[model samples]
Target chain A: MNNWKIFSNGLFKENPVFVLLLGMCPTLGVTTSAINGLGMGLATTFVLLLSNVTISLVSNLIPDKIRIPGYIVIIATVVTILEICMAAYLPALHEALGIFIPLIVVNCIVLGRAEAFAAKNTPLSSLLDGLGMGLGFTLGLALLGSTREILGSGKLFNATLYDENYGILVFVLAPGAFIALGYLIAIINKIKKSL
Target chain B: MEKRLESNFKNMVLVLCAITLFSSLSVASINALTAEKLNEVRLQNQLKAIRDVLPAFDNNPMEESDTLITPDGGTLVLFPASREGERVGTAVKSYSNNGYSGPIWLMIGFTPDGAVYNYTVLEHKETPGLGSKMSTWFARGNKGDITGQIPGSKGLRARKDGGEIDAITAATVSSRAFLDAVNRASGALSGNADAVSGATGLEASPGATPVEQPDATTGATPVEEPDASSGATRVDDPSRTDTSLPDTTHLSPARHE
Candidate 1:
C-alpha cells in the first residue's frame, strides 16, 4: 500500500470505532462530554502510537508464540506512563477520566493493531498506521460525545447552546451512550455507503 | 514481511521475560519522575478547596489545622481561618461512608456562628450524571442550596427523608451522604464529639459530657453567637467550647442501603 493509503486507511475505510468497532468499552464509557471524549481519545492515541512502534521494532526478536503477551506488556507500560504524565500535568482531566485511564490497557484497538498491522510491517509504516487509527478513534469519540452533550444537556464542549432544563436528560445517562452510539454508527455507515 | 523468529519454548520464555522486565523498568522510571508532580498537584487542589470554602483570611489554615477523631474511627480535619488574630471561619475536611457507591469527601466552610458559608467536593465515587451532581447540587442559589443554613440547626436531610434540603433529582442517596458529611464537619467545628459519632450509628464515648450552651449574654457578638439549639453532646476540647455544633440526631438512623 502507498504511504498515504496506509495512514488514511484507519482514518476512514478501516476506522477503529465506526467501521471496525474496536475498543467499544472506552468509546462508550468516557464520551459523556466533548472534553472527556477528546482526552480519552488522545490518551489512547499516545498508547497506540508507542505500542505499535515498539512492537514493530521488537517483533523480529520475539518468538511468535509469545507475541501476544509481549504486545500486552508493551501496551500496558505505555498506558502507565501516559497515566503518570497526565496525573502530573493535567490533573483535572486526569481526575475526570478517572478509572478509564487505567482501563485503556485493555482496549482491544492497541493490541489489534499490534497483531494485525505492526507485527508484519516496518516501524515507519506501523507508526503511520497507529497515528491514523488513533486519530480515527478520537474523531469517532468526539463526534459521539458532542451529539450526546448537545441533545442531553444543550451544551457542546460544555458551552451552553440553550437552556439545559429543556434538554433530554436520558441522553446524559448510560442508556443514552448506547442510543447515541447506535445513531452515530448508522450515520457513518450511510456516509460510507454513499461515498 | 520482516524476518520472523521461530516459535520455540526457550525463545517464548526468554522473550516474554525480557518484555516484562523492560516494561516494569520503564514504568518504574516514569512513576518516579511524576511522583513529586502528582503530590504537588494534589496539595494545590486541597489548598484551593480550602480557600474556596472558607472566608477571606490572612492566617494559613493549613498550618493551623486540627485533626479530630470521630467516634466511628474516622478523622476530620478542621482548618480554622483567621483575619489578623480573630477567627473568621473554619473549613472542615469531612467525609461520609453512606454514598451510593462509596465514601464521599467534602470541604465545608462555616461562619463563626456555625452557619455554612460555602462547600466543595473533595472526592467521590458516585454515579456520573446522577450522584455526581453533589458537586454543584447544594451550591448557593442551586436547588439544594445549603449555604448559610446551619447543618445541625434543622438537620441536613434530603426532602425524601423529611428534611428541608432538596435532594438532587434521582440521587437521594448521594444528597443524604453529602448532608452527612456536612453535619460531621459542623460537629467537628463545635467540639461536639457525639454529634460526629452519632451519624455513623456509633454510641458516644464513655468520657463524653453533655455540652453546655454558651451564655448568650456573655458579650458574644450576634454574628458569632454559636447555635445552642443544635442537640449536640460532649464538647471534646476546651479550646473549641465556644464554637457551634450542628444537630445530627436525625442522621443516625439514615443509612445507605
Candidate 2:
C-alpha cells in the first residue's frame, strides 16, 4: 500500500511535465503534431523506463565518483535504441520529430529519475517510478499536442474533423507550442486547485 | 590493514571496468540490431517522398542506383533508379541559412539532365504558422511545376521577391531560402554532371547534419496551404539557438524558441 502511494505520486501529484517541469525540450519541440508528440513521448518513455531499470540494477556496483558518467552512457545507449527503432518502424513520425529524438539523451526527466528514484529504490520500484513519470510526461505532451493540432490543424491524428483549410495557423508553429503549453499548465493547475 | 586497502581499490577498479565494458557492449548490440532496419526505413522514406512527386513511378530509392552522399563526407550512396541506363530523377538533401526563424535543411530532387523535379523540407526552425507552413499545401502545389531553365544562370527566389517562384503567405522568408537552396543544389549538379557523372554530390555538404526538408516541386505552379486567421498568439521568435536560448524575463510575446 505504501509503495503504491509512492508510485502514484508521480502520475498526478508530482507529474514530470506539469508538476515537475522536466523534459521541456521535447515537450516544447515535438508537440507541434499530436502524433509526433505521442511518438516522441513514447520514445522518451521507453528510454526512461529502460535506463531506470538498468541503473537501479547496477547502482551499488557503480562507484560514486563515476556514477554520473555511467548514467549518461546508459541513458545515451537507451536513447539510441529508441531512435533507431523509430527510424526503422515509424519513418514518417521519425521524420516529423527529427533531432528531438537524439535530444532525448539530455532530457532532465530521465536523468532525474536515475538520480532521485532509481539510485536508491529497489529495481521494481524504480521501474514503476520511471514508468509513471514517463506516462505523466507523455500525457502532458499529448494533451498539448492535441489542443494545438485541433486549433492549428482542425483535426486530430490527421483526421479532419472540422476544416483544416479554415484552421488557425498559430496553433501549429513554435509559438503555438508555447501558447498551448501555458494553457495546458494552467488547466492542470486549475484541476489541482479544484481538487 | 594496508593489504586490505589495496584489495578494496582493486575491487573498485574492476567494477568500473565492468560498467564500461557492459555499457559499450549493450549499446553496440542494440545498434547492430537496429542498423539494418534503420537503413530499410530510410530507403522507404526516400521512396515515400518520391511518390509524392512522381506518383506514377512505382520503384523507390532502393531500386534506383544509390548516389546520395552521407552527411559526414564519408562514402557516396547510389540508388538503383532509372530504367536499363537512363536516370529518371535523383533526390539530394540540402540546407539553407535564411529561414524566417533560422536555418533549414531540405531535400532537392532533379532529373538525369539535372533539372529540379521536386523537393521537401527535411528539418528546420522556421516560424510555424508563417515560415514552417512551407512544407504543407504551398510546397505540395508549388512542387509539381516550379522548374525553368535560366539558360546561363541559376535563378531561385520567390516571385513576389523578384524570383521565378511564388511565396507562401507570411512565409516569404522560408520560401526564398528554400528556393535558393534548391536552385543552388540543382545548379551544382548541372555544373558538374559532365565532370562527375557517376559520382554522388552533396547539395549542402557532408558536415551539415539535421538537414531541413523543402518540398518545392512546381517551378511554375503554386501550392496553397491552410489559413491562419484565428491564430492571434503572439509568441515571439527568440532568433537564437544552442548558444543563444533567449531569456524569458516574463514579457509579452512569450519566448517560443
* Best of the candidates, lDDT: 1
Q: List the residue pairs that clash in candidate 1.
A: B152-B246, B152-B247
lDDT of 1 by residue, B1-257 (tens): 76678898888888888888888999899999888989999889988998899888898888988777753467899898999899999999999877878789999999999999999998999877778888998999999999999865444666766778998887777787788788778766775444443333133322222333234223333322332222232223232232222222223335443
Query: Which candidate number maximizes DockQ?
Result: 1
Docking class of 2: acceptable
- Model 1 has a DockQ score of 0.75
Q: For residues A85-191, could you state the per-residue lDDT of candidate 1 as single tens digits?
A: 99999989999999999999999999999999999999999999999999999998899889888998899988999998888878887889999999998998898
Q: In candidate 1, which residue ranges exceed 4 Å CA deviation?
A: B71-73, B192-257
TM-score for chain A as predicted in candidate 2: 0.94
